[model samples]
Target: MSVGGGGNGEILVRVENLKKWFPVAAAGLSFAAKREWVQAVDDVSFEIAKGETLGLVGESGCGKTTVGRTVARLYEPTAGKVVFDGQSIYELPAEEMRQVRRKIQMIFQDPYASLNPRMTVGDIVGEPIDINRLATGEARKNRIFELLETVGLNREHASRFPHEFSGGQRQRIGLARSLAADPSFIICDEPISALDVSIQAQVVNMLQDLQEKMGLTYLFIAHDLAMVKHISNRVAVMYLGKIVEVADGYELYAHPVHPYTTALLSAIPIPDPGVEEERRRIILEGDVPSPINPPSGCHFRTRCRLAQPVCSEKEPELVDRGAGQKVACWVT
Candidate 1:
């Protein structure tokens, strides 16, 4: 399903019928070479406004990250169109794509892993500037310090190694590096998932502040529904490599139509004891089906509590139900 209507600014990113599949090869004597396609991200479509946060939520292995990577052109999509800034990203030449890269950046999930342990924090953050040839000599150093300060880090910290900093600080460094390229769009791929609960809030708030001050757009991919609700302007729920439900943040949480979206919302813990006790938790039975061979028709039908005969017989296309909400369920 897609969000309709474009505003004043040209659509910064438009993903149409995107798909990413990996081949799974059989082990043992089955080395006779049967290839099964793992549908990581299938036929997903969406558009991100010039300055908006589109939070993509799903359980692990639901291909949220794959979608972000595919859109970022980190992974060559098996099939689909990725139009960024009015140009087809996949069709662009290497040199043209390199220029586009400056406009789009990524903040990785793991602060520790994403930062190279061997490199100094200054080097780590400045690498982008150096690669882009944006600045040099004292000018480069000044730019690095400015980035560090922008992300709430002191210039002195740049001299230290990543191993010396806390997880939250490392994430700040990652943010600094991302900003060094002066990108308008950033793919925040679960940037806070690895931090402590307290640290997570700090990092998230910093990102919000940066967005406000810089007018940055984001494709936030995370499994944390509560955090997504807090940060996102709009949200998209993914299942089996497809977007099952998409709506404004408050709208989606208040009136989730898709069965899978309902189940996910039910699982989020309510702080109020009375509400927590009264809420019925939707415990989805059966494991998620393998992407290599997802179920026919509705991918969620296998475990959907409200599934009907038609759900199993035909795939539901995402249809608009008014109020800027789209759902892909037969019952909805």
Candidate 2:
């Protein structure tokens, strides 16, 4: 769903009816015990145009990471089709998929856990180039240095271990590693969430700069609304396991239709104290329901103020309002 605008007329990624479920055995030892499934991603659909950044935002455990992983084919989806550059990625054979992965890469949330403690930054960044056989010898070393420099790191930092670098610098190294694959589409899974607030802006600015320079498409997953608004051309709000609303960054922030969206935007603190003091905050009553057994119909109905009886009986489809805002809600 390319909401708010159709974008550059060239779609790079299209995910339709995507569903990923993980089976878990019941606690009982009996063979007759029923198995349950964790519906990580349920019928989620969206689109990303070439050179566009789509921000996916929600509270923690809303399945944002799972969606990104499934789109990248890191997780085997239980159902649905992921079409990238007009090709159905899930249908590809092993060798073809390996080749396709070169164009699709992910920057994970944790800078500390994602990198190897023992490996030097040089080895980590050059691993992708080695796997794809993109370069070797002096050429490879030069390429590594170039990548390091591209992400604000110098050639000297390449020889140091991950432990020697700060959180922001470590993230830069990870970004350089992803660039090593020469990917056109990158999934930034909360890449800045672990860093300090000051460092977050630097990373986001660097991402925007890289996107403009490289013509990159990103599925930026994060919980920071202000940062998302700054970097994303369009934004999609995810709930329990589904997308509830999508719109242009400005439109979504300015006029949110869904109750859930309104509540989310209300939580972002304003810079001006005058406006902040006058604004009304929407404090949701209950905690987020479990993904294992989300509420029937609308998953957010339980916490929604505008929810009606219909919201409990029928799940709303994401329908487009005027000016390209798409929302799934019974009452706006």
Candidate 3:
């Protein structure tokens, strides 16, 4: 796979102080009881430059998907601003937002569940065209076929049902659908996670090819560090709901500052037996703390081996650590 460089340009998607908290209510007793908010995403801020792919990597339930969904306007953020192309997306009215939706699209995690079973592959891929009124009849059908071919699928397969295809094929179909409207920004929420291990490289390569050809920007959210390193220009390591570190992909892998980032990179399996044996695995004890009632200051403090008293007392703001990298750990 060829790694492409990002061009200098204005920010395409800017998420400032983003927060998405889901309410969790008690099952039993009174219906009028107050609900507790699950802090899915808390005070997260980042910017994606035009034509840049910023991979958001973290463990499951770290609110990566929530951040992506909130940016895509699928879920209304509890607070903060989502600015797209110099305009505040959250502030847009329904009519205007409909147009904004065309430029921003999402490829969900589950390809099988994301596609409509009742609809054929043609309708599934052409739904965006119909909604945006970009094309109709023969023109729309031709566009759908074009998209299918773009994502490595044959035009003939467009008429088949999604259930008839394999997992990888379904994901390619999903990609074709997302590209139907020619979106500039795509939120790839673990798009390859559900596919076979062998097919993961193919999907990643396809995305990389499409990004270069179409000048597409991606908010690539996934837990696969290896894949992220391969495809992303830069990567943001997220812990709890906040981004702990952000740096160039190679730089972050070579010189990870945050304890959490260090531990995550250490876990990536090495191919060479001797090298793997020599590498030290940094294991953090215990599960991630509940988002509803997270630790007082640094969320990772509970599992952090280098945690000091000050870590629990104050939250660490993501600060520049020289060389265009930012880290949010007290020790770092």
lDDT of 3 by residue, 1-332 (tens): 01112346678888889999999885568988778889999999888889899999999999999999999989999999988998899999999999999999999899889999989999999999999999998999899999999999989998799999988999999999999998999999999999888998899989999999999999999999988888888899889898998888999999999999999999888889999989999987999998988999999999999999999999998888777688998886
lDDT of each: 0.91, 0.92, 0.90
Off by over 4 Å in 1: 5-9, 31-33
lDDT of 2 by residue, 162-246 (tens): 9999999999999999999899999999999999989998999999999999999999999998888889989999999999999
lDDT of 1 by residue, 14-132 (tens): 99999999887765565566767899998999988888889999998899999999999999999999888899999999998999999999999999899999999889989989889
How does candidate 2 fare on TM-score?
0.97
Off by over 4 Å in 2: 1-6
TM-score of every prediction relative to native: 0.97, 0.97, 0.96
What overall lDDT, based on C-alpha atoms, would model 2 receive against the true structure? Answer: 0.92
Clashes per candidate (backbone, < 3 Å): 0, 2, 0
TM-score of 1: 0.97
